[model samples]
Target chain A: MGVPDPADAELVRRARNGEKVAFEEIVRRHGPAMYRFGLRMLRDEHAVRDCVQEAFASAWEALDQYRGDAAVKTWLFSILANKVRRYLRSQARSVPTEIDEGVIHSPAQHEPERRAIAGTMMAALEEALDELPLAQRACWILYEVEGLSYRRIAQIQGMSVDAVRGAIYRARQGLERRLEAWR
Target chain B: MEMSPERDLGPPSDLLARAAGELRQLTDDGWVRAEQGVLDRVARALRSARPVRGRHEGGDFFLSSTVLCAQVGTRVDLIPGVRASSVRIVTDDVDHLDAVTLTVSVAYGQAIADVGSRARGEAAAAATAALGVQVRTDQVTVDVLVEDVFVDEARDDGGADDAGED
Candidate 1:
């Protein structure tokens, strides 16, 4: 077998010591998930790209200060979350619930009828998610879609475990009411 | 059956489940291009960014701590069984190189003491070459701290044994 890949902690340790390649390897490994998270949170193609890029740039600059208290993935998500918040503050505008053409298209788009329905459902869900308070949206996405644990979400959100639980609970209620038509 | 507005979160309903799945599968036309863009930008920034600098002007010349630590780090990494994680060069008030500290990780089963000695020697040599000052006259000090041990997977014999150490 080929040489085993280095652990994330190992890469972080190497990165702390001024190894560019180690950090780049980290970017390659985690960049896709980060992209997905950004797309779901920000919903704007340009905004997602910018947030992911800036998150990584900030991560590289702050590598020395990383204490490894949290998993590298958790830490990265935290940084990306902060960047997303900063982007939102700088804009100070309403969260756009509209689905862009570039966001997603059904793989089975050949069926016109099915594609239209799928598009509607996707847009509806996006709208429902967008209606949530930013904190609830972030907490819900991280917990449900990303499958991160409560503790991990708490660390990323800088909230207590109980607080994260409450946010997620409220998020579920909001989504359920918003999407009740699908029931 | 009536539904209560105040209800505990249950397992995701069918719609919510599908929505979550769709979120997980999100992709865009520009995803691949954007990811490459980020990597390229980060790599370029790293190459051009000057992280920290220590400049000391002697009678006729100046020395940079950033360059000094980088050179020292390279030298330390060249030693057989150790990889330098961080290299620091401390400059005195007059900008003379005062001390160097090297944090390193050693390969599993390697001799820690030997690795530390070689790392110190290489670091000192590199600093002297960079600063144009003799170790004795400048009183350059080198400290080597072995902070971790890593398995040499390339050298492994491909055994089925897993010892749970990285």
Candidate 2:
């Protein structure tokens, strides 16, 4: 019911009942967004894609846990978010935080404000987003962009509403600081 | 237990918001494909999960054997508690049913004679015909195990089988 299509419920039912077609629909519908969302958060193309795939695989196995209360999209994002967190934890050991100034703050930052379009101007925003602590970035994405309520966002991020609010505030502050000139 | 219902509006950048929207669409579409793929796989899995009968074929022959069981067994009874969900024919040894004695499981309350039992025989005959096997009815020894018993007072009253009734 939470999803736009009753077909989603039917798909969920079939998936729960072991229908492969239904499962495929779920994957196809969510896979690209999953990768992109994970990519935006994780910033490593390979790691983000892996996390997205891992999340779908995990959701496939535990599909019965989908109560239809939250949209399957929401449930999947939660899974993806968890995978990203785990990835971050693993990477914390091998590679210290190193910002890719070339891919991000390259000579491209020289463009004037009037030409400051989302297509180009958001590179620093993206870098700043990528640079954020994973939790804060997740909060910002779910809250300000995805338009999910703070409560649901909190559930996905494994943080309290107050903490989520703080994360969003901090994420916003971080973004504004990086793009202060554009404002 | 550590779960909470906390929420957030995400990062306050409008461009990022738009990007996330576009990203969500992309993810949703991709997942639709993934779901379809998984659904196909799951359907294949479930279909394969059906109970396979015998080393080769002749699953339907079991029903024919059941019929033969009903004919030869001392007890005139019916199967109970279920219906004929599905029936299929498979390969069998040419003389598989020749003097083969087996117990037949059928339900009483859940199956009607003309529907379940009769249909079962019909299916078995079809299967036998399909296999090019002419079931003579004499070559098979089927013992119907009457697991359920009930009084059909109409038959017990003998109003129909009574030869005296013109």
Candidate 3:
């Protein structure tokens, strides 16, 4: 755990006091990351946008119940994780179909050498991520990419800490095997 | 045959870092364009999800706080010598539209008192026109933001000079 962000706390306070702008600020601050998480989970841009919207709306309606126990980011991510799961279930899909290479745009497109290396590595990693089971992938992303602790990931995923760890461990092993060529 | 210890796999730290970086890049690119759209969608969804405020004698009715905030925000922005950087409306009772508190920010260097009064009057008028309800001036509070003082002051001073030459 880290120090609570005062700005986020203040925003949350004002939002709770019925300030629409404060709540909008909260959505703006966290919306992009939530969108990214949705894209990674669902791999559909439209679906990602819908999921992020649903999650924020849900958060806003339930703001009164938010106890401030978790960081606002974590709270939002938790809501988003639930939204993604519900979306997946609603679609009657088990695994996300394929990695959309179009989603991974190079930040420096003109730098040929860096672009080639990053593109290849990113493609490989996306494949590896796709290969992971949904649970393992969720845990891996929350822990490794989002820098959440195993306990926090467990809370978000509704599992034990050990289970989160095991899932992450398996995900890492699978990815390492799939990405050995890059090393 | 069992795999050799030397070949045992581990976490792909470097790959993970690179992937995180790539994912961030992808998100950053999309976000710049999608931010306002996303907020609008979220705002719409939230407003729709709220309970209906019940029927008036005229017909069925529901008032969206989001819409009201936007109206007030627009009215404040249209005021001379002031730009509404942010507008926040606190509704104590969403169903009745009573005890509403409007908080707003105006561009700096203008007469704060005059701007505040005008903003309150305009917002109240806009809300009454839009919602068919009286929004009293006492319900609005204004905060003057000094952060944009330099730019606003420059624009104000330069606008007249440029206009005279033209």
Candidate 4:
């Protein structure tokens, strides 16, 4: 469902021509979404911001090499994903490979009666998302929240399209099972 | 590899669709504010980097084009009764023959020709001063948009009295 952004393309062109403001405009447009993606992946607010900063710096350095083969957002996401992965690896933080069943089953606490259902469902969803493996979580977020196609997700994650589809499928099933009460 | 059954793969599309809708509602207001800090860092980094390449004083020095555009745009913006929408610079093979195209919206009751000329002069001057190179006046093109007049400020000042009288 994503369409090409003509304004972004023009800004990219100007940035390539050494327009700082144009590049800054590009940063303003995509930075928030990139930060959100990084936060979802790393789950560390500070780390995510640092990773996004590094990603944009790297993108600027490599601006001339960008051929526009993919949308700028896709390109930026790929860079941020890789940066987050590298940071996680360097920190030696163990990413849980298995989904935590306990989190899935825990009942929402202190929820208001009026919006109990929606609040409980949302809480369950967040817990289920947090329990997913990094790869699957990234796939789900990109495909579901970001509205990226399977092909774009595959490219960003450096996997085959079928692999991306499989990851999304697994993530969806896990969430569905966890939030079956809401359904 | 053997294929799994469709049932084993995931939930039905409708269920996943509902989940996606609910998840999209989540927001992080803090991250929105944090983005400005990241942008500031980016702007500083870009400012320090060399952005333009040209021959200066028989030697060569680089100027950041981002800085150059901002300077040009700022100058054009400083002119009352007009706002610079976009500024783009194109250089020929020698890099000395620089051409600038500026898109601007002129306020109503302002002469388009005068605003265009002033924007052109200001942009060229700003580029010359910032780039340390003489930018030719003839190479600048001001693309004027007469439709984008700011009526709110005019209305507050009673400046649109003539239009109101009609």
lDDT of 1 by residue, A7-91 (tens): 9878976775678788888998888878877776777767778889888888887675454445678789999988887676555
lDDT for model 3, on a 0 to 1 scale?
0.63
Off by over 4 Å in 1: A1-6, A93-118, B1-10, B28-30, B47-90, B93-166
Q: What is the TM-score of chain B alone in each candidate?
A: 0.60, 0.29, 0.51, 0.57
lDDT of 3 by residue, B30-59 (tens): 555557776786666443223224344696
**How would you encode candidate 1's per-residue C-alpha lDDT over B1-166 as one tens digit per residue?**
4333234345666878887887777553446757887887677654222322232454435644545666777777778767777776676776666778889988889999989988888888887676566654236678888988866645873322211211
Share of reference contacts kept by candidate 3: 0.22
* Clash counts for all predictions: 1, 68, 0, 3
lDDT, residue A149, candidate 3? 66
Candidate 3: list runs displaced more than 4 Å: A93-119, B1-12, B47-166
DockQ-derived CAPRI band for the predicted complex in model 1: incorrect
Q: How accurate is candidate 2 locally (lDDT)?
A: 0.51
> Which is the winner by lDDT between candidate 2 and candidate 4?
4
Question: Which run of 10 residues does model 3 chain B get worst, by summed lDDT?
Answer: B157-166
The most accurate candidate by TM-score is 1
Which parts of model 4 have CA positions greater than 4 angstroms off? A1-3, A93-119, B1-15, B46-166
Candidate 2: residue A31 Cα off by (Å): 1.9
lDDT of 4 by residue, A60-160 (tens): 86675454546888888888888977776655434445434222221222233214435566666667777787778888888887788775776688876
Residue-wise C-alpha lDDT for candidate 4, range B62-86, written one tens digit per residue: 6665556656777877898777765
Best first by lDDT, ranked:
1, 4, 3, 2
